[model samples]
Target: MSNINVDEVEEQMEEDEFEEELHETIRFLLVEFRGSLYTFTKHIANMNCERVHRPLNRRPITSRGYNYIHKILKEDPTNFREIYRMYPDVFLKLNNILREKTHLQDTRYICIEEMLAVFLLVVGHNTRYCLIRKTFERSRYNTSQNFNKVLKALNSIAADMMVKPGSAVPEKIRESTRFYPYFKDCIGAIDGTHIPATVFGRDTNSYRNRHGKISQNVLAACNFDLEFIYVLSGWEGSAHDSNVLTDALSRNNGLKVTQGYFFNATSLFNFFLFFRIIYSIHYCGVRYHLQDFTGQGRHPEDAKELFNLRHTSLRNVTERLFGIFKSRFKLFKTAPPFKYTTQTEIVLACAGLHNFLRKECRSDEFPVETEIEVPPSSSEQVYKDDNFGELFDTQEQQRTNTNAWRDAIANQMWSDYDHIVNKS
Candidate 1:
């Protein structure tokens, strides 16, 4: 018993010594070298015995934290060359939040550079763990395990940094609202987007609600500045946007707004008054309409010709919300090749990181393009009064459904719009 106790003490002391040595070594290295590709390679070779003899590339630098900075420069070469230059005050702000000595032990990927790199990957590429691993080969960690750890760590950190604990808005944002009155009463804008996934036959109908595919319903709430405030990304894709909102409202403690309202589309209803509805028209001609249900007649607003004309057009926050999110992260913009579980996590991580960068940016200039292809000619016909009423009546309907939430709420807000339209 005595010998065993002695050995245990010795092992603990050795661990402490090893930790101290590692820290000292990293500090020494930081002081010793300038961040050139050749110098970085030589430094890593000396410090990490596991690194192989491949010429240093983007991946290795990613592990070391230089590439995220490099990427910032590459993207905006005309504006800035150094990461520190673009975000001069960021390190100081981060240091105040992330105390240096606390997260320094037993973490290969905890450094500021690595965290930012992980954030960039999730939002910029939204790539898989395996692909990220291949991209940063110098990481001496299992791809999946490290990826999950990074995500978990980021969730806690970002939530702490960006989420205003007990309040839905972040501190900087709540304070900034004085200058930007659009954000004054607004806590966030809510919406749902579909993430594609594979479906099993047994679970086909469960995942195939009204949307027509196997997908996870991704629900997000962004502030007026378009930074994500809350993200709930794992509901079945077939789930209605209302259902997703219901889940998110119930899940997170901070998101439940007991007092105020937010903005969303008409798909969400009166139970959650937190949203100001964005009105849209869905026309189906009575004859060509393949749907089982009969039209109540033309919308009263259609008859009065006032639904589009009378109301003060509030900001289309939801449209801009989808545009900004998908624009920054291509993963959510297009259908992914991955199956469900992986797809959900990727989306969640991207949302979390979006909040992080939006907080970090000194300038809100999002890069205009990412080489993503857009249709040169939109095939969607504009709804003009002349033929629009006749046009939609001809379309086929695979599913005839009304969101229960929407039906319940429509009368409360748009009662005037409802009274004017005529029925079929």
Candidate 2:
């Protein structure tokens, strides 16, 4: 028999040790606090009822809470503290809004504040449900049995009460004043993003596609306020953003731009007269904006180029929404814990929350605008010729008209956006 490979044995041993440590760490419980829906109810009940309750003992806290808490908080102590302090106030405000909605029952159910607490805790800590059970020890929600129940309750409320369809343009969001005039014909900015999810499949074709990738393609739209207006989740990761957009547009009648525009990236192809697509083109490696009906790049230095820039600058509403949404929920930073079904629900819920916040706070006027570094100019980069000519034919009548309208609308909006940006 050959001599045993000591190096291989040591590597295997190390791997086993690492796995064991991970298992232990995941299961270990740190300082148990009393923060649960049951405890929450008890606190309310105690406030109203003339009953004496037994006081619970305080114990040394675990590193898990601090570790998870650190993950969500910003690096700068001052900034982190400021946001942390606002959590309670924001919770109360969101709760009051939910109460006003009439969707929640009046029978001493979970309040909106508690629901906000759950969201903040989940987004901030990215911790498990059971660990959250430990934080509110003094409250009525301490029972182990009610952990899932509370989560379900919060989910239901978020779905039914917090979210609203943004089909119609609100007066506040509607363009007004030349500095930032309402884009009357444009409905929303559309985009596709990747959110990680785990799925089981023996037949690779079931989930895998031409791209040979594994992830979910989430198509979401945001209004002018940088609020997520609509979400189309559950498309396979291999699906192109254009295909996802096509499916979403077909599925929802409201999404089909009958009178207004739906701005998207340049990858999306041309559509009919009713639906206008304003996208950007990458010329010489540098992304130049355009509103092309034929989906073809016409002139680099023409008025059309300026129109594309305006279109992109405005259409980028969805991009900012994506950044902020994922930054808040680190679960999106990596793959989601749940499968596709639950993942879709969570994504939609997050979009709703994103819009809810945008509606609640219209202006995020920060003082330190210059603190953020500006990206270096790429105007002089080497240009590559993307074959937009293959996508369209100039002889097509509808395509010609569509391009004309797109150009006109873009020119109008560009002047308006430029004024707004300049004033700011």
Candidate 3:
């Protein structure tokens, strides 16, 4: 009876042990299944959230923009001037000069020609960067980067392109009897023009001119050949021409006036001394503009009018230069939304290009006989400052001599003009 009771107890213990081992196996399998399911679900979510980077400019070789540029250069070379504001040869020559002289280099994808084209499109037509990107079939980053690279390259060769005046008299002045002896000492004409500008914040007021437009008062000196010799830009529109001139003369790389030589200016700059600048007379009720003397019986009646007529003729060159410059580069008419410093650099670069074009192709699109009438002056008050007077007081004797010399020339010019009219 005792042996049978012990056997029953052993059998019950074995059954309990087997049931606990089965439970442990089932729990391990359940945890392993949950972990595998969680990992699979996380991977699916990640696949759904992944981003693919598609290229904006694909197959650039077959792009329409790239084809168009090459087509214009090869098949339609004549139209190149209309598109780039320069003949193909001129453009190529300029490109060569820039490549040889500047730090600009051809990248793996973009050649120097394409880079210059991008810059010219922006400066020539004021085309926006987005449009340029589409035209050139380049990414935004490439278009902007190349435009700036070309700009810096052009500026690097500015000195060579924008040549200064030599001591010899210009052929235009030397050939004309009306200007020869009178303006023999004159090297160039100096004037101030307003270029459209874009500014922000409190600086807008400072850039607002008397004409109620935001602009930059750019002072430029141009030879009679319609080429810029010196350009001083970046002054606020509210600044007077004399003030801009003062700053230009004070700068280290500013306009340099050779001794005994003068620049022809308008009546606005009459008070300037220590510089041999011959300005028009500001007498009240006198005819000073060129249009006033452009009729059948509108010849000058006095010495002052005679001097003014000739001065207006000589000074009109600067106005014509500005006209041609703005017409060539529409960027001057409307300012692009670039930094102010960049805008100033653009002005200088454009001037350099103008000079280059003049040298390369003298008979370009600009009409030689186009009559550009000088705009009438809005104010007759000659720019004067007590500070300027005090600074230049020591040169009073020189100023007096200049005034006397001007009177003598006017008298001589009137005498010659009167004699001619009477003889006719």
* Top-scoring candidate (TM-score): 3
Question: Could you give candidate 1's per-residue lDDT for residues 269-354 as a string of tens digits?
Answer: 32333232222222222221112223575333332122222111222444465666676666665556555666676676666555
For candidate 3, lDDT tens digit of each residue in 1-424? Answer: 9999999999999999999999999999999999999987886676432222235645233244545666677756667888898888888888888888888988755778888999898888889988988776777878889989998988888867777888999898899999878889888899998899989898899999877789998999888888988998899988888888878777898888877787888666766675554444333468988778888999878998888888878888887898888888888878778999999999989899989988887888454334333444666254657776575777788768777888898899888888988899
**What is candidate 1's CA lDDT for residue 153?**
52
For residue 132, give model 2's deviation from the true position in Å. 1.9
Q: Considering TM-score, where higher is better, how would the candidates rank from best to worst?
A: 3, 2, 1
Sort by lDDT, best first: what order?
3, 2, 1
Q: Which sections of candidate 3 miss by over 4 Å? A: 1-68, 275-285, 367-386
TM-score attained by model 2: 0.55
Please report, in order, the local distance difference test score of every candidate based on alpha carbons: 0.48, 0.51, 0.80
Which candidate should be chosen as best, given lDDT against the real structure? 3
Give candidate 2 misplaced runs (Cα > 4 Å). 1-86, 97-116, 137-184, 203-213, 252-265, 269-300, 362-396, 407-424
lDDT of 2 by residue, 1-424 (tens): 2346887888899999999998777665321233465676877676633233445453322233333343544355455424432333344565576566535432233333443455555554465556665653313242222323334444555544332334565443355442134344455666677766667776335455333445688887666666665678888875655556667667743344443444444434333222344433212233353333225544333444555554566666666677767765656755555556776777766666555555554553222111121222333121222533443353367666656665665577566556756799
